[model samples]
Target chain A: MLGKVNHIAIAVPDLVQATAAYRDTLGARVSQSQALPEHGVTVVFVELPNTKVELLEPLGADSPIAAFLAKNPDGGMHHICYEVEDILDARDQLKAAGARVLGNGEPKIGAHGKPVLFLHPKDFFGTLIELEQL
Target chain B: MLGKVNHIAIAVPDLVQATAAYRDTLGARVSQSQALPEHGVTVVFVELPNTKVELLEPLGADSPIAAFLAKNPDGGMHHICYEVEDILDARDQLKAAGARVLGNGEPKIGAHGKPVLFLHPKDFFGTLIELEQL
Candidate 1:
């Protein structure tokens, strides 16, 4: 159902602080920040040897990260992404097992320009699970 | 400061159910369960080609996972482990940069038999970060 962890998403109240911590302090190779208007968040990828870490900041008031930051304030781990060979197959299987696929139960293009779907946090034991087609 | 993600730990109220979800439903290779009395948690590793997922259940009433599950109810992503080239170097740099290392600021042998230290969740934007010496 899940291939590998594509990236772990962290929601930060301050993108500059988050970026500096990972890039300058952690000495991780970070990509330039990219704003995803569709997702209503700006993101930067911290490249690791085996995987990547995604730092997300709210783009607008309506951004979901805005709500997350409202509660967390200091920011926190938002969600995790897992790569799947075929997202449709994964979704079908997970749904059959009573997992709730979010957002109209359809896959949408994600930051990597790949098909992705979100599973409800309740279904995933309080962890928002993202499945990306690799 | 960090090498690669060692594993993602999820605090589950029931380890058997969590193991079944990952192994039986998701079809991932799982290792035998192990109890870490020092950490007060029972754990199992879900092996993936790229990395591993650690399922944690409270081993005692005072277990940290017990409190986490009490709040979340359905369980949730607990902490993330990142591998480090040198534990001392990583700790010194993180401390110098104003990050708080948890529990006496010393490394302890983790489930993988590697030197590990936890960074304060507050310093890490509400995300508990574990650094393992690779």
Candidate 2:
């Protein structure tokens, strides 16, 4: 079963401008930015009392967010992550229920250093979902 | 100041299929479907322990989701909502900081029966954000 939302990620064309909107304008506390080359993204976490919002930008031309940014240009809400008790159990349950898990069907260490897996958008009505084990 | 996230909205083409996937497959508790004609959309709320996911489908051909669906046939994540303690203060602060509040910059009663307003996607890194007064 899914727990509370872990973080909602937004694919942004410019991370600085995007992060400023939350940090400078909204006055929300934000975490230091981290670049994850493995994921091909530069991430910044905006802290909220209840949950977090992750801002992601393409690390390079070959980055996956590049494709998304190409279509959106201005960037947009990319995906949402929900917490689960067990990554393997959640994956198995989701797979049995006909949901397609992304990657090699195994959970990888996400930005939070937790095992996370992405679900196919098609199976989720076109919304890409990430399951993070807490 | 923004409170916890209230809900993330997804524009769906088929409410029945979308709601069923969440209810049957994901096992998330869902609320009864409600159609808001003035907004020209039908909405359903998927209850998560910490937050909610709202699914929106065009009530008719003229519905707002119709245009979005035309662009994205599979449906997709539409917008995300953040709870604010005082909407007027939040709106003014956001406006002063140069954020574009969608529509007439006036809050409307959303499906949750709370005052809500949408921020333009352009000003917020292409993510349409909803500010809700809790």
Candidate 3:
């Protein structure tokens, strides 16, 4: 069970190129752009009517996004992030349901400075999912 | 470059069980339910404010959804469907941009009897994206 989708993260090779493609081709505009060194990625936010599209580009060769791009060269949709009320409670419930937590068993700063934690894709499915608590 | 998110499709092992979980745990009501044999799947629609969530479960053992569920047992988000104006035009543009089309290069009956086409996830990272024309 999840709430409103906070954002859909798309992994790209280059933020500038991907942002421009979404902007020029799709008419989606960048509302915000920030680099999260902790995650080893840079993100550009495209504000949609009700949902936002997040463009993520790996900052370094060692970045996880880079590996994902290597595995999937077309650079498509990455993860679906759902907004939650309490990060801890959600994490506990998910863990109880056998979902593996990727973070340090605690909420960490995410893109846009929101508290977030990632659930291992192996535990949920092939899809990588993020739980964000604003 | 996109409009509002039409719906987020999640692949589950059992539609009834998944729908019940989303309803009981997340309070999401099932707005619609249907079986699309062409797609070899059954779908349950959960209405959100601006975007809806589609729960997908394979109809048979040979169904594609079943293969996906086998690859990732936990069952999670599948595809991010974007509402498009013209399915044919969208497919043409996507092909021009080097994206692979999964369908017979034509829109067919989708969940809720809407015309839709699927873009090969291999063409756009690992995410299977669907373009639905309402």
On DockQ, the leading prediction is: 2
Off by over 4 Å in 2: none
Q: What is the interface RMSD of each candidate, in Å?
A: 1.3, 1.2, 3.6
Quick one: ranking by DockQ, best first? 2, 1, 3
Name the DockQ score for candidate 2: 0.77
Best-to-worst TM-score order: 1, 2, 3
Provide per-model DockQ scores.
Answer: 0.73, 0.77, 0.42
Per-residue alpha-carbon lDDT of model 3 for B16-124, expressed as tens digits? 7777756654545675568877778888887765678788888865677887788767786778888777777877787777778895788887765788888877655
Docking class of 1: medium
Q: Can you write out model 2's per-residue Cα lDDT over A14-120, one digit (the tens) per residue?
A: 88988888887787888888999888999999988888899998996578788888899999999989998998998898899988998899899987789999999
lDDT of 2 at A32: 81
Model 2's interface RMSD: 1.2
TM-scores across all candidates? 0.95, 0.94, 0.79
Candidate 1 residue lDDT tens string, B1-134: 67888899999888898888887666678999999988899999988878888999999768877878888899888998999989999999988988888889989998778899999888767788899987
